[model samples]
Target: MPQPPIVHTHRKPLVYALVWASLPAATLAQEAQPTVLDAIQVSAERGEPASESTSSYTAASSRTALKLALSHRETPQSVSVITRKQMDDFAQTDVNDVLEGTTGVTVESVETDRTYYTSRGFNIDNFQYDGVGLPAVYDNVQGDLDTAFYDRVEVLRGANGLMTGIGNPSATVNFIRKRPTVANRASVAVTGGSYDNRRIVGDVSGAVTASGKVRGRVVAGYQNRDSYLDRYNNEKQMFYGVVEADLTATTVLTLGHASQTSDTDSPLWGALPLFYSDGSPTHYQRSTSTSADWSYWDNVQHNSFAELSQQLGGGWQAKGSVLRLEKDSDSELFYQYGTPDRQTGEGLFAYPSQYELNTEQWVADAYATGPFSLVGRIHELVLGATWSRSETVDESRYGQGIGTALPPLEEWTGSYPKPTFDNGISGSDWTDKQTSTYAAVRWTLADPLTAITGVRLTWLDSEGVSYGLSKATRYNAVETPYAGLIYDLSHNHSVYASYTEIFKPQTEVDRDRNRLDPIDGVNYEVGLKSDYRAGRLKSTVAVFHTEQDNLAEAAGTFDNSVDSYYRGVDGLTSEGIELELAGEVSDRVQLFAGYTYVDIDTANGHTAKPSIPAHLAQLRATWRVPGTTGLALGSQVRWQSAIRQNQGTVSGGPNDGQPIVTRQSSYAVLDVMARYDFARNWRAQLNVNNVTDEKYIESLKKFGTSAQGFYGAPTNANVTVSWTY
Candidate 1:
């Protein structure tokens, strides 16, 4: 499939503001009280019943990413937070490992550590690091940061261009980094697993100045997995550091950096077939390889960012952030596939390829807020603007080989995935600049009602240079609007609504290089939300609809250029319901649960996007006996509906005009964990994943699939221990 264009998420929302109206006094605020939901008792005017928590726009709301992480209750939107504690418990290295049990979130692998993320049944490739916007990429990718560098991970679902710049209304992911501590602290951990896996981690933090005006922290970690997939194996190294300084009593400065590199000797795309005659889904051996398989990846990524904050006196506050990042990947992978030579029972297939990609980015933003009451009542409105730029280039080559999928054992000849390296840069040079002007106010209206209304105007200008085909070509771009509203019922509950717009530019264009109008989309949402339990529990339920216009579907499989793909006659639309919950019961017991139901169709009522699972559900829990301080147990079960892969088409394959087959069957997996706190300074833990060893498709696979093919992981596990100082 042609990759989706990179999307900017920090841009302001427009157009949508003109289509929706703000309800009277709907902003909600949490109060100083207690209830079943606890910590989040706030008031609204939208007729929502009083609850223990709230999703309000009060000046005290929407703090740092850490605040969101600390919150266990419902906000007006669908959100999830992964804490440092959770990372420590699992000794998680990759983002996929860290979020496996989180509610409202799912992570799956296409190959090795390379992965994908989805929320509310939509592909959410965009992510924010410390509130800084990052462009979304279509390729299977990995974030450079390790769990040792993050204080927490925050997930915000639905239209978010108001805070981000550009993106699908799907959802946004933000990774909050840990800061230096004024107190000294240190810890270490080691891990071992089934695939001959081994890992070690070290962390240290403390004050650098006598008066505690300056402090710093550092983290280092490494992991090595020998693997169960014949020659597939890898080793990863991570380093992270953070520093904070108080220039004065009211001013402070903070900076942080993270770097990671992974070297892989093998990555299994697929195994050899046991019996082509059987044609059953289950046909593979544990220790299978077509040839003496080998793969390599020299991956490197680094990120550095600084933030400044100063109290302006009064009830006002101000903050700003600047960040820079760089990423480079060089790799080679080969495998085998195809029918065997009848008598030899050996197939003649091979795939060999090599490529490199380099990307770097710089982004900055600033915002201010204070008191304003021009609408009706008093409100603390926030005003802000952001700018970001990223440059990426790809170089590749192809050879006759089996495929990136199957292994290349003794039976294969002819390599197909030959690297196109000699062909030069066949892609392009890209850049985008955007600015937004937005204001949000919180109206403290009648008794239990409050409202928050915000509007933003954003302008975008993008240019790209395609350097292949013997000639140099370039293209330029243009802007759009955004608005949102929330109604509070009382100190505990509320209902909210939001309308946002998204604008994206495509690299594929007409023969003349004339850039087409930016593809546009509008999203609408109305829902109920609440949270409580003094930082322990939260729940949110909502209904939403999204419509995109001027979108171009497949002009034909290979002709994905703008000139070739016509505007989709029906467009794309989606409507759905979602519920999420999380919390801790009595410190020793904790749980997270969520469910999503979605309906999507072409503007003309055809099929939905192939990647997303229509229904997703997960429940996880951890518990320990109150009196015993050493032992604990954990379990998580997840369920997802079959994936929707293809639609009727004439130019493609055998089923021309017939609905393309391959529906990933609905499947479930269960994982368990056991922990022992041998002493105050030491602990041990073990995790069992996919306990049932069920075989099912976990990805929206295509490549050479006939009908329904491909399968998820069979099963895996890891064990670890820690020591504190």
Candidate 2:
């Protein structure tokens, strides 16, 4: 049946123009507002920002770190940069909110900043800053970085053998610190909303000396928020400062420090059972209150960085960075498991436990890159070497295995009624030391094309100390290779491709008790780039493939596992196509859209690899009425294909082909935001997330034959107010 079409009532141009003019006049007479430029500051190199579009190429501009960390397209590898402008507009506090829509990037929330990033089919446990590489502390020590401290984030999509030599060929992320500019600016903000939350933040930066040689920037913030999960609440505060000095006409040095502390009322190791005699979601009946006396823990993090650069004679320049990062977490945790009863509202539990944990990590590195001459010809080159070491120690044993549901909601606090694994996982320690040497160069084969080649060799040694035994494994030096090309399609566009090597040392050993060969990976990628704005719009589309050898398989847990818990290089493959379009339609209207199609397979014969999805699409549009400059509105839509659970069943169960439950059902999520210019120095904005209130599962904790579930959150939004003087 066709519906009737029809009526167009048009407002006269004279009337519309008159209303538009009157509105602004009235606003100006009653309130003075900030300029539109106040909401955004972009470092879109080459006038075009890199997004997921195949038509443009983008690179991180040393500024705008976390702000546009999710937007840029720079390398043949898929890279996402979420900009501070985007963060301010959406008031994104958690990194999860900023990355949930990235192509091939899955943001799985275990808790607040404990969210994890999974690409293709693996977790990113190594991260770099400036030029320093750090061991990503997840299991034992995990912490969050306040977005306010970053200028921008640079992401290289494939094996970053040249930058961070220890990780996957799947991806790498770098956080570039914000430097002091030759300008003075200061701002502050306060916020309040759902769950009795409150927060405050401040940012200050500018030239501190008359000569502008000595400049500094600082950012500090604090927040307290109660959550909806039982025994869950989070409070945090952070301080970040950076200072720079120009000692000579051609030399620059920068020193910076960041520190943060967070106390969580309660954080679950994993959700309780989600099923009972019948199959249904238990979350619906569980207590909304958090534990009264539980401690997820209060953690602190610190990063110290120093960088120096000098211009040698000729076209040669050398730069290097020395940095260190530390994370510490200590807490006691207890909780029960179960699905909520359909009628009683009480969650039924099948297992429960009490535990305590303490974790710490520290890493340091230094490297340099520059251009030089070989013979009489000029050679664009990069040369560097680095060393890193880390140690992880955990203490505990388990308790009595839980066999039934948890008690009533009122009994939410206290030590676990019975613990598992005996005394708990106590006196467990693992230490690793790695060193790398690398050198690379880019040659201009012609006016239209450039080629890059590089290699990294690393040596690794790790030891486990526990009980009365210490087991150690040492890997002789291993060499990794790389090569890439960029062919200019034109001044504003290019066709580029590259192949790079990757490797990750095994934490668990193989049969015969020898350290297994590291997992090796190779990445291949090709794409195009563009520049549209006098220097603003950016776009890109590309295809990538990665093959990893010796993927891990657990015969047991991260601790006690059966012999040969690790396998030799088998076959693990991932291939995908990505596209993105972003930039200004006008000074007031901005648009960004991205799409990703993936084809990933596991020779181990599993279908779904953890958090990776097959398809993802997203679009966002912001329209600041051209004439009514005081008001702005924006909307976004994100969708992904259904995810398969690749878990195989055992004896009484099934095989590998059987997937776990759908944790993320390729559902479309919506988000909205609006900003109002209240006065010259103040602005107000509202942000809404998960607007559709869709029911989804984020992850499933499987214990052999037992599988329990945890439900994802529905709609959650917050409001923000800001001011400047």
For model 2, residues 226-331, the per-residue Cα lDDT tens digits are 7656557788898999998888977889899988887887665545444432343245433333332434666787788787877664445566667767666665
Runs with alpha carbons beyond 4 Å of true place in candidate 2? 1-74, 111-113, 138-141, 277-293, 335-365, 373-378, 397-405, 408-425, 466-471, 509-516, 554-569, 604-611, 646-664, 700-709
- Top of the candidates by lDDT: 2
Candidate 1 local lDDT, 1-725, one digit each (tens):
22224434443333344313221222322222322422322322211111112211111123322112112222345566655555554445667765655555556554454666665545565677877866564424653346667766666777666666554667777776766766788889888888888889888988999999999989898977776555656778999988888898767898888898877765544334322222222244444443234457667888888988766755455778898888887776554444333234544345555657777878887877655333334555566767777776666554432234432334233223335434222454555555665555444565455444555455555554544421122222223344445565645566777666665544433344333444567777777766555545656787888776655443332232111322332377878888876666555676767788877788568665655777888777778767777888878788887775552333333423544343557889988888999988898999887899977654653333322123455678888888977
What's the true lDDT of residue 620 in model 1? 73
Q: What TM-score would every model get versus the actual structure?
A: 0.80, 0.81
Weakest 10 consecutive residues, lDDT, candidate 1? Answer: 50-59
lDDT of 1: 0.59
Q: What lDDT does candidate 2 reach at residue 63?
A: 18
Q: Model 2, poorest ten-residue lDDT window?
A: 62-71
Alpha-carbon RMSD to native, per candidate: 7.8, 16.1
